[model samples]
Target: MAQIAVDSSPKKKNFLRSPYMLTIALLPIILAAWWLATTVTKSVPAILLPTPESVWIAFPRVLGADGFGDQVLRTLTEIAGGFALGASVGFFLGVLLSSSSRLRAAYLPFLSALEAIPTVILAPIIIAWIGFGIEGKILQAAIACFYAVFITTLSGLGLAEPNAVALMKSLRASKWQTMVKLRIPTALPVIFGGLQLGATTAIIGAIVSEFIGATGGLGYLMLRYRSSFDTAAYWVIIFLFLVIGLVVYLTIWYIEKRFVFWRRIEVTRPDLEKQ
Candidate 1:
């Protein structure tokens, strides 16, 4: 499946060049470098970076621990809630503003100012307002997500064919009909592009918000592990972050494949033996 994205050449391709194999190869290669540096050479101390074995053990320990699931659920909820809230608003507002030049001129600068501020900068303020609850993290995530989708929606709606729009107007189509039949379909690909980006952005926002102040969550757990010098546990959280980002990203990508199926173009590269 991974190879399908990378190997588009209409010729015999090296099996070793397959992305699936190359990606899997990263593990042993990294482990070997890590083992050599820490276990063999002692050049990198365990206190700063734990051995792979330690991290391997920590994964099971972390997963099997009581309440670990609760913390993970809290984090996931914050990310999902934030994304849902932000994306919904962004899509609606994008439609509204794009419907009129006056609306865009009236509100675009304010939105631009909000987008200028990073979610990290808002973390402390959000926590203070919401009192370290998951709500604050969700707000942070929402902030992180809003601009990407909004801009993409604007870009997409603007891309509707001029002739098609003129035809709609000539046919006395209502704004809603025009949007449903033409504008939204045109905008979906671009909007989904924003959504794909938001999948990971929401994670960063939630995690950083948790860092500011939180009772539980992966970010809080990492901070706790750091204070206690639990290096392996810290690494486990790092890996969890990576995993969460990838899962969300792939989910959005799959959904995009469905909704925007027309955008996909397969270029066949038949086996050289068959040729």
Candidate 2:
């Protein structure tokens, strides 16, 4: 007689799944929706609402060698340059303000005033001062990005609990030592939040500047296509904006995941823990 064997192992599901797989799964559904809308619709004219295939075909013309690729490159360069300058300056100022009460009180009002100024409205003035080249775009992006990082960093600097700071002082830690050992780590989540916000705003700032006056970029490309009534190409430029925003958000998200991994607050479910 054969004996039955018993096996016991925990059944586990992976929650950290790849986003690419999800995108692939949704592709078919999206295609079906697009096909039905374009093929079976008398609700609207085709010229007003073109098919997904038309948009897809136009994408190559918009992004290919003869199209908007060079423009995209120029925009990327301006955004990157601007964001780097803004984030660096903001981070340093944030650290300084956090460490000194006098400095915080002295400069915070000025910072707030800077933020209150609508940078987008000043595009023409910026162009007048810096010209329509990369400089104006960089300045625009930098100013917007500065506010994002600055505000977030200020919040992060104060996020540490009072008790934690007291304990550090009780241990006879120097101000700098306490900052490095306790405060900065506690601020990681908040700082990362600022970085994400800044990165996103940088893109918007760059695009807005490009729109005001640009020789190249999706903004310029859209303008060219619109003048010629190439609405398909116009839509393609809009698609490029969506892609650029998604890419910027994702890149910062990846960086946050890497640096702030240790800062996660673990939530324990009583029922699960009891089991």
Q: Per-prediction RMSD in angstroms?
A: 6.0, 6.5
Model 1: lDDT to the true structure: 0.87
Worst 10-residue lDDT window for candidate 1 reads 264-273
- lDDT (10s digit) by residue, model 2, range 1-275: 56422222233544445557798789899878767877566454556666777788888777784845678888899889889988988888887898988998999999989888776797889999978898888888998898878877877878888888999999999989988888778887888888888988888888888888887877777788878877777878787788888888899888887887654422123433354
Local error of candidate 1 at 161, Å? 1.3
Which residue ranges in model 1 land beyond 4 Å of their true spot?
1-18, 266-275
- Which segments of candidate 2 are over 4 A away from where they belong? 1-39, 45-48, 65-67, 265-275
lDDT of 1 by residue, 1-275 (tens): 34545434566677887777988889889989999998888899899989888999999998888899999999999999999988988888899999999999999999989898888778888877878888888888988998888889988999888889999999999999999999999888899999988767888889988887899999999899899999999999999998988889889989898988755443243453244
Worst 10-residue lDDT window for candidate 2 reads 264-273
Cand. 2 Cα-lDDT: 0.80
